[model samples]
Target: MRAFSGSRLAELCLVLLACWLCPGSALAETRVALVVGNGAYTSTAQLPNPSHDAEDVAASLKRSGFEVLQGINLRQAEMQDLTIRFARAASRADVAMFYYSGHAMQYNGVNYLMPIDAMLTDEADLKRFVRVDDIVNDLQQAKNLRILVLDSCRDNPLAETLKRSAGATRAASIGRGLSKVEAPRGTIVSFSTQSGQVAADGTGRNSPYTTAFLKHIEQPHEIGDVFRDISSDVYDSSGKTQLPELSLSIIGKFYLNGQVAMTVAPTAPQAAPQPDPCAAAEAHWKAAESIGNVSAFEDHLARFSSCSFANLAKARIEGLKQKTVLAPAADGARASGTKAFDGNYWDVTLNCPASGKAQGFTRALAATVTNGVFHAEGQNPGGSNRLEIDGQIPADGKTTLSARGTTGASAYTLNNLAPGSPYAFTIDAQFERSRGSGKRNEARACNLVFVKR
Candidate 1:
């Protein structure tokens, strides 16, 4: 080798040092994304912006070195297949992302993303739909970080016209917007707007949310900060009507545009800093509220121990227990032949027959009768467990009892199997009992039984 000057030797040494110090010398981790847009709906209004959103997002992700799988207007079967494939791809990825733009429904706090070919009726039959929970479960297999972005809070037209079948006692609460989601550690769930609110499809080619996302996603900043910038941009673009929310639990830094810095030497272990008691309590409280379950509340109380909202959480837990435990108990009473419908306590059990391609189903109701009005609480076999029914029981006993759904619940069509009227029941010794079933227009059969308590 030829001898070099002092300056050249120093320059060569500096270059070598830089190579050893930089993380770019090593291979970058892989980033994978699954993007789906379902705008073509068979039973509801077609969305105009979802497909465009997916395409634009995919292009941006590809530019940032993400292996993107983009799909448009996928049906239930196709959507399922795509998710399964995505799961396999994500299992080896360092960062896995899922972006969905479509119609979503929330029933009993569980969110379901509807496929393009889904014909959602009044009933909340989630067996065929892709649940958000299932998506989270699939993404949880990723080796590193996970990101879930949902821009599917558009106004749903199907929610208005969808009616629950007759003889079904409980109807699921069909809300307008998607509900809040609880994500696991190392995962972030971002929403186009706050929970229980709808988002606007902008006049431009891309939605306001997607437009903002595209603008900030490639910025050379921490990924969480990028989302914060996007949130601010969307909030302003939507005229303050929309507020994007991010539920983050990421542990380390994730840069979309560049390589992460490497720590050359290990640092000494230090005492962990104390967490702010109020802040920790609030975070737990918010999670419980989003989940809206008794177990969540109970866990919060157990962990926080002395939070300010501990009493309030306890109260909510008690109320949820009543709904969960008491309502099912009523159904159990009817099923086990311990309770019946009468003048004092009207327990009407209705079943719908399988008519014209529909399956047969049954519903049970337990109500307290006062005056001539019958106040009922019903539960469906495959639907909601908290259905409230209000009807009038005739004094003649020959007349049929017509009941309707109340409190944001769906109406039950008690169709009589025999000719004349749909309501067929008996007034035994002391109770008003109905012991016949009927069929509705749908493919399911309806049956009714009345017993006295």
Candidate 2:
């Protein structure tokens, strides 16, 4: 029987040769990554952990087929250069990832992603140092999956007097100016903490949460599934502390090293970002110029120093100033009666043909008018409120204030509004129950009515 079988050995050898000799049989190589860890804040607390974390994650991403570029403690110019390079890489790569761990702060409302060396002593310092949208939107245009992991929510080290005036309460709740921007399609953005929550930069060699993240990233699973495990792991490790909230509006599932998912986690939802004012200001500037309201155009530019429309605002304002023109004469001043409402000695005088509508004001919360805007002050326990303006708030642009609203708690919402009509706005910011322990309670929101004055 053995001798008979040997007669066909040449045929079997031929078959085996055919199976092993195929070309173009491998999958495309997955190129990905931009890992940034900025831990050297000159003005505030130094984050020793982020640099280590960046180094670690960068190595991990590289091992999995990422054509990695690493930047650490970059001065302003280096940071911008890296961002530009990262964007270029993303456009061609199969997958793009951005990881930043460092100090970040939000002011006037726009969030600034701070490098370790950043010191926000003056509002203008932010313009010189950090380039937020450049980094985010660049990756947005990538051909494949876009993944951003920002552990940049550390305690702002800017001197107390130099802080951005967007009312913040706890170390955890200090706004990092991230909420106003959107992670584009095919992107998954995860913060170390919730949007309004601050994550702990642990006292250990690495931040507790980030250490957990690094641990799970290499595990055999889809990135999203890995994050769920990371989220659970971090929570358990931190003794049931704040858990990470994943906000995703991804077109499809993204894989690590192109390994198709063995596990799928429920993706998070993307919050439609409130409007951007610079986006509006650019249009508004053109509108004002079209209407020949030089004065109006000039005024809008002065307040929004950091808007994406800053240059346009500056140029337009100079033109208007040189022309020395005023708004048309038909818009005469009107005198509406005065109504002053005082809460905690904060008084607002609503005068002149009312500047707009009365009922547009929200009754649910408190309100106050300062610098011609309404805000509900003292609504939260520490009096922090966030008043998002109408229209898209430019990622880095100027905002024209139409009306300001805030509760006593301190979250202020100022609409870079048009003086279309006189607005009669009212805000009642009453304190409600705490949302959770070790966290400030949510303040009430009030609507303001602006009418023609």
Candidate 3:
């Protein structure tokens, strides 16, 4: 497969832009990628489109100078893990595209990704499973050319779940339009079917959408032309079973054909020993407990020279930085006094680090900090967090907790603390999940943030 090293993506972008000005073709290396497939669900209905779509797409991506991440039958955590990894890969890429084939639903206007083992029996489970905005936004965060392909317009599977839990007339409406906001300068989003519209399954083995996607993706066609062809092909092939949509205001030229861009940063004379960039970055990475801090993560990753947490950390940082969220480093200190947690929740921004396997899966450690007292309790490996303070934390709470290490994944419950504890706080854990979209890493455990009161 054609490869564009992270080191090269920067240099190629400039060339591609210049080539755009000229008429003829410009031979520049474009780092392209394909994230494909999402079949092998346990309880939910299996997705045929992803398995089929991934195959042709990966091959086409290879031809297009793209690296591919593939997964099948992935859980929510696993899907997010792979997606975070892909985001890191996109860091140096000039052109990044994410494609998916899976089951998705909307509830109370919130969109969710249907994981293989998703037990969507109620509305509250949304936190347990996948969030659609999370996936799309993470990809949209990539630094350069961004393209999103959503081949998931299947009929809603959680119709019963929504009706029972949400008391809504329908399961979830596939809302039209992108996030009701314009994306960065260089971005394009393509959907298999229009919002709230269902695509048809094929009479034969392959679904109509996949067949059309495979047909147009490889030809020497502009992105817009390809979409038009796929749209027409789907209508004709599946008895008009599917209708696709595109929400794009991209002003630049995006060619499936090899086109590249490059830029150079002003450099100063070499300075001696810049200190361990990783160590310096800890302050930034550990700053905000919430997810979507892509900038800090990216800054840290670029400076490291093959650290253990390199891949996962990089993905997490980029995921948060790219997403248009407020996952900044914690600025306001937790109020002093005893604080209570209301069960396990996350500050997920990116995928868990591979090192987290060693740190354990728990996101935070339960501790009691009151009146100059500090304690660490509930040190269970991947168990529920049931750490409580001696008294109720003061209402004027100030001071937060910090939990680092990718391996720590904890479930916490903080309650019934001392009545007059001066200070009580929990580390807001930010977990990260890479998109599986029928890609591998679906089985990868999603990072969790434990809370106990």
Query: Number of the top candidate by lDDT?
Result: 1
Native-referenced Cα lDDT, model 2: 0.53
* Tens digit of per-residue lDDT, candidate 3, span 46-131: 76667767777787777665667777667778877887787777766666787777776654344566667777666666676666
Candidate 1 lDDT over residue span 189-255, tens digit each: 8889877688987778888899999899988777866776777688767766687756677776677
Give lDDT tens digits, candidate 2, residues 109-224. 34567765565555667686565556666676667777778786656657343544423432233334344343456667777765546678898878876898788887756565
Scanning candidate 3 in windows of ten residues, the lowest lDDT window is: 434-443
- Residue 382, candidate 3: Cα error in Å is 58
Q: Give all candidate RMSDs, comma-separated.
A: 13.8, 19.8, 17.8
Shift in Å, residue 311, candidate 2: 47
Candidate 3: lDDT of 323?
45
Give me the runs in candidate 1 sitting further than 4 Å from their true place: 1-26, 122-125, 163-169, 259-453
**Better candidate by lDDT, 2 or 3:** 2
Scored against the true structure, residue 120 in model 3 reaches a CA lDDT of 69
Top model number, TM-score: 1
